[model samples]
Target chain A: MDRFRVAAVVTLRRSIADVQGTTVEQALHALGFRAIENVRIGKYVEMEIRAASAEEAHRHAEQACQRLLANPVIEDYQILAVTPAVAKEVP
Target chain B: MKFGIVVFPGSNCDWDVYWAVRAGLGEEAEFLWHKEESIPGDIDCVVLPGGFSYGDYLRSGAIARFAPIMGAVARFARAGGLVLGICNGFQILCEAGLLPGAFLRNRQLRFVCRSVFVRVERSDTPFTNLLQPGAVLRLPVAHGEGNYYAEPSVLRELERRGQILFRYCDAAGQLTEDANPNGSVANIAGVLSPEGNVLGMMPHPERACETLLGGTDGLTVFESLQRHCTMAVATSAVL
Candidate 1:
């Protein structure tokens, strides 16, 4: 079986307020970064899975997000990447 | 009446709920470990107390909702058993889908800990049957993510169905913006499930149930539950 590395991003839905993101945006403005606006914050989760194909790995990652990683009531999640894991090099 | 207080890995208020029910309110109460598969048959009510269950990981209560005992809790709730979730317990209830709506980080981005006045929106539910309509209660709410949120349509439904139990208010029972400690929608502090058997609130009623803790206004909540259970038993016997 091939090992795939998966990464996902979970963010609050647009309809809900992102207080942490708003706080960070305000701090950035205070730091003189005027161009930054609507800076939303979210969680980045990464993991490795053993699956036959990238499609299988993606499906597992999606299911994980749906069941555990992301709460659908207020947050949205996206599978960022599902790349095959490379073998480690011997020292 | 017997009460079961579920204890998750990070549950810190299990004993507080125990004391509120066992000592403060004079009821039989016990702790049910999160790993337990089922609740005892004699438990008349289940309480999810306030605390950082599972260390508030992955958005508060998100992880604790999957605890082994939660399956039984959900079944019990579905069977029309009474369930009261306080603070983090409220978050867990929402995450577990036992209740509608979700919590957002406090609008001020701070963990607010103090006594806040909440106006009783309705007194017919099991949680507040002893209280008067629009009664103002002083309860302590300590949490960082108590800002309750729901879709506008859901909020309308909650209002239409009289599911809203408490709303943050001023000492004089006014729904002023300043009285809202966490910017919850419509200043809501508590709500009831569609079946009216499950209740979730952001405030810590157990913490305020004793005079030494500063007020006894919260005692009425527990007392109301006892009264409701007693009345139900009497009615069932008559039937």
Candidate 2:
């Protein structure tokens, strides 16, 4: 089986309520990170996918994230990477 | 005595814990926000309620472990105070290093909601004193990341110490894979700390506390704690 590492960076959907994000932005301002405004928080997920093709791996990762990782109603996400990047590459 | 339930964003079960502790245990349980700097004083027990804490982002309970209140929870638990975690709270306890193991997506890769049977493995812990070994209780569980994972040596230690509190069981109280909704190691559905005061279980005992809510099997859990506290009070009075 072909395998790929799917990493998802999920953030809140623009329309939904994210009380945590607002609180964080206020805290950052207090810390004097004024330039880092409008900070929205999300999660970075890295998992190995076993599939016959990279495309299938991407689809699997997408399903996993949508069904469990991110709630569809208030959250939206785009697949970040389904490729196994070099170990030294830092994103 | 006062008890506190830590609240997080998207925590759907904070009220459930409140009802269970207040009505079922008859204790004065209060709500604690995630941003709180310290726990309320003279707390007899601390509860970490289940829900999508940190919205279940960055793994089920990963980010919530870094919440401000958790630092206080850890300090209190380490000082021999009682701690209980349910579902996502269980995940957070593991993430916070108050308990061991990690909860992952169900191997079936679907959210599972069902009534499950759990066999009592030990009754020595304060949380399980009301039940006997091998007793079975039916409880409802609903979650996506319920699969529990831990390394071999640690699993062995938990086993040796009787820390494994509950195991998924068959209808006849036999441990079976079919009963384990998630692929938890050794079918472990709950666990306790070395001191027996800290408990983390995926099943929502609080949800089953009242017959009107469908079942009362959860009462034993809180009753066990109440009994222990009552005995302690009497002993102190005599002293």
Candidate 3:
């Protein structure tokens, strides 16, 4: 088994209003950065798992996103990146 | 009828609901820990109370929905047992897919804590049976993520099914933008499942049950549940 690190990104759907994101956008506008048009804030989750392969790790990560990490009602989720963790070199 | 109040780790309103059910309403009630894998078979009603369950981690009620006790709660609801979710509990219900919609941050980007008026949209459900249609109730709400949102189609279906139990309204019982404390769509404050057995609402009825607390309107909701349970038992006995 190889150790894999995975990150899940979750964000509210476009149709749903994001009050926090909008607040942040307004704050930025107050700072004179008016060029920002669409700024949406979301959640980023990271975890490590032992899996046989990267594909297996990705599958497990997706399942976690579906079951607990993200709510499908008003948000969408994606497995950002899955890579094998490298072991430290012996001194 | 026995009422079971599910107690998540961060749940602060479990005891409040217990007290309301036992001393206030003089009904049998007990606290069920979140780790428990089973609910008492004799429990006719289950309540998911308010508070930051799991500290509202990963969004409100997002983590609490995965608690072991929720499995039993889901089973109970499937069996047509009455289930009520208030405040954070309502978010948990939505996260668990027992109800539709998700709670977003308040439109004002602030945590609102105050008493608000809500109108009984439908008096036919077990939760609102004691209330008259269009009756206005003053209930206290405390939460940041109480802005309820859903797809247009789902909202239409909810309306068509008469599932909306309560809506925020003015003192005169008019639904207006000013009356919406959290900017909930259609000023919705509470909703019942299609079956009318499960209810989820942001208002804290348990907090409003005592006259000493300046409001006794909340008691009517519990009284309605009691009445419904008694009739249900009686009908089953005859069957």
Best by TM-score: 1
lDDT of 1 at B145: 95
Which regions of candidate 2 fall more than 4 Å away from where they truly are? A1-91
Off by over 4 Å in 1: A87-91
DockQ of each: 0.78, 0.03, 0.78
User: Candidate 2 deviates by what RMSD?
Assistant: 15.5
> What DockQ does candidate 1 have relative to the true complex?
0.78
Compare candidates 1 and 2 on DockQ and give the better one: 1
Q: Write the per-residue lDDT of candidate 1 for residues B116-143, one digit (tens) a residue.
A: 9999998889999999998999999999
Each model's lDDT: 0.94, 0.83, 0.91
Give one clash count per candidate, in the order shown.
Answer: 0, 0, 0
Best by lDDT: 1
TM-score of each: 0.97, 0.73, 0.95
**Residues forming the 10-long window of minimal summed lDDT in candidate 2 chain B:** B101-110
* Model 3 per-residue lDDT tens digits across residues A1-91: 8989999899998888787888889999999999997889999999988899999999999999888887888889988899888755689
Q: Name the weakest run of 10 consecutive residues (lDDT summed) in model 3 chain B.
A: B122-131
**Given candidate 1, what's the lDDT at residue B232?**
98
Pitting candidate 1 against candidate 3, the one with the higher DockQ is 3
Cα lDDT of candidate 2 equals 0.83
